[model samples]
Target: MWTEVNNSLHRKFEFKDFSEAFAFMTRVAMIAEKMDHHPRWTNVSNGHQMFLQTVACKNSIQFINRVFAHSNQ
Candidate 1:
């Protein structure tokens, strides 16, 4: 699950293996590129940590975290 911490949305996800984790990151990259909004993330072995902050308007900001469940790829 995602948690809001220090004005950032933070989440940790676990995958079956490094391959699955990498595939998940790749998908996220596509979405980020399309939205023109990138996030800070870290991957190690079978785990991934993501941190994001979303700008809603000129004065409003929301932090959000999306966890991707890995499947056969």
Candidate 2:
């Protein structure tokens, strides 16, 4: 499950390498673009962390929940 932190839904994922981590980000980018919802994220070596909040919506809680559901899949 995604956790609420820093006014967003936060998740951390570990990858085998930078290549794999970037690949995962690319995949997620496509999905995010399709949804018109972008995420704030950081990558370091094989570790990745993401925070999702909808800029278009005033209700961040609901937007975060929707983003969490989509990302968890």
Candidate 3:
């Protein structure tokens, strides 16, 4: 699940390896681009951390819920 802090929706995910992490990023990037919403993210070792907030809405509470639901599947 993701948490909200400082007006941002944040999530941290651990993968099996670097390859899996990058793959997950690729998948997320595609969906994000289609939604016209982008997230702040980082990859370190086998973990990926993401922070999502909408410039238009000033927060990502709604968008994050939708995105997280899709990503979980």
Backbone Cα, N, C clashes tallied per candidate: 0, 0, 0
Residue-level lDDT of model 1, residues 9-46, one tens digit each, is: 66898999999999989988887776666777999999
- Summarize candidate 2's per-residue lDDT along 1-73 as a digit string, tens digits: 5788866788899999999999999998888777777788999999999877766666375654565556655
What is the TM-score (0 to 1) of candidate 2?
0.81
Question: What CA root-mean-square deviation does each model show from the true structure?
Answer: 5.1, 2.1, 2.2
lDDT of each: 0.68, 0.78, 0.77
lDDT of 2 at 38: 73
Instruction: For residues 1-73, write the lDDT of model 3, one tens digit per residue.
Output: 7777787777789999999999999998888777777778999979989887776775646755466545644
Model 3 per-residue lDDT at 66:
60
Cα deviation of 58, candidate 1, in Å: 11
Error of 3 at 19 (Å): 0.1
Q: Give per-model TM-scores.
A: 0.74, 0.81, 0.79
Better of 1 and 2 by TM-score: 2
Q: Give the 10-residue window scoring lowest on summed lDDT in candidate 1.
A: 64-73
